[model samples]
Target: MAVLTSWVWLLAGCLSAAVAEDSNVSALYPPLWEESPEQISDYRLEDGKHIMDPWVITDRMGMYRILLKQTAPYFASYAPENEQNILWGLPLQFGWQYTTGRLADPTGMTDCGYEAGDTLCVSVDSWWADVNYYLSVLPFLAAVDSGILGIPSDQISILPPLKDQMMFCYTVSGCQSAFPEAMGRWSAFFQYMQSPSSDFDGLLEYLWAAHTSSLEYPTRAFVDRYAYYSDQEANFEKNWAIAVDYIAATRLPTTLSRVHSFQNGLPPRVLVDTDIAPYIADFTPLQNKVLVLLNVLGNIHHFTGSLFLTAWESAMSTKAARKLFLISFEKFLETSS
Candidate 1:
């Protein structure tokens, strides 16, 4: 009984440590960080155009930075410091991806995103970077179109990637033409953001609708890219994609604090073939268990239909209920084990 008590204490300590990590928010920023442009005037102008190259990691992040700054007024009434902005998740997640080397080329053929070559480079070969492009670049274009950026859509031009030029759309009109559903959804989100009636939950609903829609095409298009990564990384990518749908269905407001806490459960870096979760020194037992659960859920998602997800989405519709459900579920699983 004493030995069991000691183990319980250790587990509790580890969980406490994870919770404490939320205060170390600087870990969420990418390496070699610099202040990003908060407005269009900060960007370089080329022949009456605001020039942006979304292929660069910082440049891509700049888009989100600008977006949050522009949209802060809409969310100010909900909470102070723009902490209530649902859009915080996008830039925060992107920064986490970069800090963890998910933005690096996993193919080992290029040094794009490697500190030795070009630290700021966001490789087109990276599945994380490519999928993130849809999340970052598309919404940015839509913001311009919706007049949130205070610029005409055509006044801003995003540079294209080298190989997959045709896969991405550089201009608002081009994106609207190529990705009508995603563009429309994003435009609607901006419209709603500008609405006085938009509360936190309403913003979350609109934001997730647009966020999930933005992910649809890229997740399908980048299926082939997963082959370049390890089994663990590939599975993680799929799991994260499916998890978005689950979260979107809940309409949970992914505020800054909530997102930071939630990301603590995610793997800090791409898992290599040789890295065993149980023995990973940096991860606690709870984190290892979470990783294992992710793999199981990822596999189940692959082999099964959306019925389970639908049921889960229906059962836990609110953030408070979802939290209670998770706590109760964990307690049940622990007792059974």
Candidate 2:
């Protein structure tokens, strides 16, 4: 009986040891694996430059610099005719032809599909493309600011306002309440542009017309008419003051000081005295870059006005457009000097 009890105790000890071993194995191979070997291998390859020799890295960078230098002029031109063929030219041509009744009717109709005719179609497409081009360059400009050119990302908050304004213009439902479902916001914009006056006053006039034509009639008309002449005037003045304050805050001179400080921190081997001094001089690299960005923005703004006039006739939202206009004008004043 004593011998049997000893064997039972020994068996119990073995069972406990087996359970402990299983728990230890499970702890080592937990269910939540941190990363797969494949993911780790890919990360290492990208982060370590594929473990290439230093000479190979240098050679690749040098080749890239050479390519960028070679292509600089093409990009720098006011309008590269060669690139025009690829970017705006073909798209514009196709858009113009399709909308102008020169091509077969897109809807398979025998007659010109639109009562307003080819002009309206052309106008819509042109406006769409102009907006597209303006928005597309923004990312590239942001990349230049942060990556290659070394301008701090925080300094250039201008892009977001402009983007928001463009989006509001494209998608806002305020105009939809006036125009028919078929007409859409584009028609409202087109009508505004077609008006002889295309400024704030012009916008007021367009709003009045929309108000009168709307099914809501007297209520919408009365409200908008009074608001346009009175509230809008006060709003405009207030916005102008705010924009002036922003300009005072973000003006390029302040930014130049920041850029200078950043440049000062670089090792002597990486940058020379000549490079540093010239960057602060009249028409500095910083200035040149800002000028390029501003110039593009200004040109697009002006081009949009032109397209609006061509398509229907002119525009800006209250806050975004006003701020952009003030900033661009201020930069232009500095550039003129």
Candidate 3:
């Protein structure tokens, strides 16, 4: 009986030790299962619907926050001063040092919020670093496309016009080049809607035209290279249809008519004070639909970037080319917003 009692005490002590160890681990790497009140307050999620900013919203969602925290220890383990260097800044600087045979200080490279000691700022800085790096690579990509990578002019013909298409797709002012027919149709529809004699039948016709142009047969020619990802392609079509339906079902014409009326004679201050809020409220659903469509389009952009990277990798077969492709892909993911 005494021996049994000893065994029981030993087991309990072991369990206590294990629990204490787990508590330490939890302190070292906190899980983000529940957001703290401070985080909620800082991010302004008290109302549940209003987001203070993109970063705050992303933080509230715990998007990459826990991952950054959990990985902090590993990052700190290798830094010279045990600095919080979360973005592999130490290693990157060391790599540059080794390559150039000179000690490189990455302090300036760290952005406003990140200074190698703040874990959260490190993660955010790393993200923006990648964004800036990718943006900076666009000119290099353009140069490569113009024959810097040594691809014969003849071989260039086989490559898709990825850069051109990307620019056309992203540039709001250049939309006419990408979808001339749709732009022309929408222009005529808007002109008619703005006229004094505009009626319900004309609105219905405009809706039909928008549906046909935007949904039934979109500007596929611009994105023809992406036929490989059939699933994404299908989603693109479906999301676009939803967007068109949302627009058609909304009080878009009425809102536009009000705008035209305001433009014609209404006092600007009166229009701003009275009409703007209702116009925005009326288009809120359409705005939500646009946000959804933007997400879908972002996915499409990622896939297209992957396709372009693959093509570039295949054609150039060089380390520089691979790096360029990676940069281009990162740019696509960042800018697709």
Instruction: List TM-score per model, in order.
Output: 0.85, 0.15, 0.22
Tens-digit lDDT track of model 1 for 22-135: 454445443333567767877899999888988787678789888877988888887767766778788878888988899988887988989898888898989999999999
Off by over 4 Å in 3: 1-173, 215-337
> Over the stretch 1-337, how does candidate 3's per-residue lDDT look in tens digits?
3532332232122111111112222233222324522222233333243222212222322322322333334334333322232222212221222232111112344332332433223222221222222111221122223332333322211111213334322222243465555545545544554456765445445534643453322333323322322343334333433333322332122221122221121111101122232243433433333334334434543666545324322443444543343344334334433
> Candidates sorted by lDDT, descending order?
1, 3, 2
Query: Candidate 1: which pairs clash?
Result: none
* Backbone N/Cα/C clashes per model: 0, 6, 0
lDDT of each: 0.75, 0.27, 0.30
Task: Tell me how candidate 2 scores on lDDT.
Answer: 0.27
Better of 2 and 3 by lDDT: 3
Best by TM-score: 1
Cα deviation at 62, candidate 2, in Å, is 27
